[model samples]
Target: MSIDSIDAAPPATAQTEQAVREQALVEEVIRSFASGGSDRDREVMNSLVRHLHAFIRDIRLTEDEWSKAIGFLTRAGHITTDTRQEFVLLSDVLGASMQTIAVNNEAVGDATEATVFGPFFVENAPQIDIGGDIAGGAAGEPCWVEGTVRDTDGNPLPGARIEVWEADEDGFYDVQCSDGRTAARAHLFADKDGRYSFWGLTPTPYPIPYDGPVGQMLEHYGRSPIRASHLHFMVSAPQKRTLVTHIFVDGCKYLDRDSVFGVKESLIKEFAAQPAGTPTPDGRDLGGREWTRARFDIVLPPAGPSTATATKTS
Candidate 1:
């Protein structure tokens, strides 16, 4: 028989029978989890369903409110594209993304602590040779950044792929502006001795974009939309694990006043300006202007395979 004929014969139920049948359907849905899903997945989904239902009932949400919420979500989606992610911005503002990163980065012993990778990262930054200048042809003051990647035991880890990117002096990522140029960002494979060095502009504090709803929320609370100057790093190796973090520039105007509250005391590093003619590493003209320098270290823990779903970095 056709499926239409089967559908026509399905409603032979009184109110009591309907209720019982609904309960059976619910049980059947719950039991379906046991058929193929992992125990952990099944448990989590069941708990999520329960709490989600409970929340809906507890709020007694009206249809108008529901419609408004849906509209807000649609707007959020509309604001996101390849370079910008409104959902991640929402998660950042709500602090859920950072919380989840913290939960997943719990490390024992002396492993380097993990932090949320901000939403502005771009993959495949122009790969440069070791000791190459990343801050190409920019107007900001120059800085020499040198760092070593090592395990918790302090052994240099070779062959680590160190990916580095950062905002310009104006507090904008390369992708943020339409200049079609990317300075202060590059990818470099580590040397045999696990040391890495690059030249970039001295990081200056910058303001977060305040043109969107997140900005409105910040304004509603009388908050400043500023984040401290920092250099973003994502270091990974074939045998070892990966770390996504930033080296906060010390003495930044917004260090103590980050709008997103992303700074940690330990991550902050001094970027001291050296006297002129301080012997350039490249033996080039140092001019009369002072240069800045910093040394940072990255520590990686055991490797964890990437999850199927995208996990928001803070």
Candidate 2:
């Protein structure tokens, strides 16, 4: 039967004999998982089974719909690779990534808020010295980014490692390119005074990779894949909580509706525009090309036990 016909049918009646059987089945599945497993595993599985059964009951899910979902997951698995993670994209668009981040990173006094760690981050990114250019050879207007790493008590965090990466003007990360070239990504350490600066591209709004199953799902739901203009940052220091976040462009139109729901009001900053011939911080000549500058002072919270529970933020 067609999906239209199924939808047009009357809703199933509750409290029937079949409904009691369904409830027993749910309990049986939960018991199967609860029988033999680690405490954490059993806890998670039991809760998952309960929620899954509840969702199936709430929607009165059709067999065809379940098959279609399995097919979509299979397609996502097929497209995922070392360079492309379609499952991560799926989690991102559904706000699961952001929700997970929110649960893990609790709010500390005066500390920078955490956001999504996007799928594009690669291990062992090239290291750059302070005041170096992270853009490498990416195609975009020049931007001067300066920042200081400090702890919540207002003490500088020297030797902190900062990993920065972003898409180019066309909204494609280095890994997305076909030539196996790496640009627009690098890691640098804070100076003795906890100061670090680098040159990168001006932030621009870009669509998350949408040529896969997630894209098709978004289209089916009438949603856009465009993300807010932002630069990714992951900072870590000894004996301090690590932070993975972004500094979004203040005036980006998509800030309110980022595809991943990663934007936080505290993370937005002004990218002050400079006319051509504006002297850069390091006095590097831009050849009369206009550029922008932004300063982001990062504050890391003290490393300690998590005070928050793993609750969904969405």
Candidate 3:
């Protein structure tokens, strides 16, 4: 008998009645959300319910398993606070963060591709001059980073703001330090020619603070929690899209296996070794010890128009 004809007819047994009831339950829950305040919210919730109900039906999840999942989420929320963001970390390791960024920010004419912003970014980082050192004596071999920001047309984008942050040689960010003073991170501005230079440290592989629930989950899956060595940058300019990205060290040990899956071929960079006493691009001496030099050029995209411009364009 056809399934539709069977549904139209009266249920013949307890099993059939339960199956109809289960299907009705899914639809009833969806209908109950008609009062959601916004169309977007209603649409999202409706879609979520459909998928979740289908998944439950397909998997036939047990009550105990569902309860455990709820407990896990509750714990994730409990551990999340001002300094620690367990939910973002959870999204990151699951590759959801990168997927969302990719879907939302499609490429813009060869502009720099965006990536996951990780959980370490801090607002209001200190501003450093073009040739200044942002590392502030963090432990690692010195590395000089020089780059320029420009548009796809090769025109320099002067006055762009660059925010940078990275872990020290020991694989700890300044925020993780006991003193709470920022190190190895600062804000810098592109000069008139769109060039920027800063003294930082060479990238080093490190674990992603894996003592939390996410770590426990990784352990369960027998996965390593190592992230590749990389320096993070967020560049912004008026009328241009802000870019959040990272420059991966060419030979970083965990490049192929970054815990959060943030590595991209376009972002990999070579950290060339420089002999002592070599003159830097800004006329500073590389003094006495071997230092690394890496050059990364950024390409920004045109931003969406402001209200006035949008109105005019429309």
Candidate 4:
């Protein structure tokens, strides 16, 4: 019964083989996927195997726990639909999507930082004129938003295209409009001088939809589902870079506690109440009560042409 005989046992190559068998089974399932999928499918599946195996090894996972995890993922997949993406919602809540976006699109200089688009971005938004209000007839306080697109050198980058959209006063976006299409959702490109402006009613803070499994997951984790009041922008330039960010409304209670953790101090802007005679460029009367206005200048990095070749010096 010597201690040396117990701790000096030989390595278990058989146990390592069993672990490989389990990992191989997972890869077999993934390899059966057919067309229309990207090449990253295999890459992701392989990486997933390594990480998942590592997790199991770290926890010494039991069969019961593994079965429970499988059931949870199955339910998450079943809860997905055309309008609702439970998977994307899961990614957002876990900060995976934000991390992925940041890794792929590293912002240089003063360019805006991109965050998760969430699961509510809908394609084919209605194109509206300059200075048009996308807020529709929603009853909320008026807010004027203006901004210019410039390069890192503080010069205007003309002809930049800026796509804008936001939730209504009720925190319901146009895609979320169960009835007819709402007027508060529109896309407007920048003016010739790289300036883009628009008017809209202030968006209200609202809890994300809690009728689904994602909601249940949030509640189980003791988390709230409220996002701060802000406007979404996707700005792109011809030769420069593109940006996806939010112009956060000032004094929002949820600014510090955005459900997705998307609030940035530099992104926040003042939303002051303006007078009735605010000379609206589009002839829309934002009069009567006071309105909130914010102006932000976006800066994009230089183009990719100069990325190659070193400069010759004496």
Question: Which segments of candidate 4 are over 4 A away from where they belong?
Answer: 1-43, 275-284, 303-314
- What is the alpha-carbon lDDT for the whole of candidate 1? 0.72
RMSD of each: 8.4, 5.6, 6.2, 8.5
Best by lDDT: 2
How do all models score by TM-score? 0.80, 0.92, 0.88, 0.80
Model 4: how far residue 269 lies from native, Å: 1.5
Candidate 1 TM-score, C-alpha based:
0.80
lDDT of candidate 3 over 1-314, digit per residue (tens): 43334334433333776767867887799899998669989888877776677667656678999998888888898887766788888888998888777775678788998787877888888899988998876888889999899997889999999999899999998877888778899999999999999999999989986787888999999999998999998888888878888999998778999998889999999999888877666776655777899999999888753101100000
Question: Where is the poorest 10-residue window by lDDT in model 4?
Answer: 305-314
Candidate order by TM-score, decreasing, is 2, 3, 1, 4
Clashing pairs in 4: 134-184, 135-184, 136-184, 274-291
Number of clashes recorded per candidate: 1, 0, 0, 4
For residue 153, model 1's alpha carbon misses the true position, in angstroms, by 1.8
Screening candidate 2 with a backbone cut-off below 3 angstroms (N, C-alpha, C), the clashing residue pairs are none
lDDT by residue for model 4 over 1-314, one digit each (tens)?
A: 33233223323433766656765665565566634467787666655665655456546678999998788778888877776677777776776666666665565787766655666655566776667777777667777788888888888877787766677777776666677675666777777787888877776787776767767888999998888887777777777756767778789999988777777888888877667777654556655666777787888776563221111100
Ranking by lDDT: 2, 3, 1, 4
Residue 160, model 1: Cα distance from true site in angstroms: 1.1
Q: What are the lDDT scores of the predictions, listed in order?
A: 0.72, 0.87, 0.82, 0.69
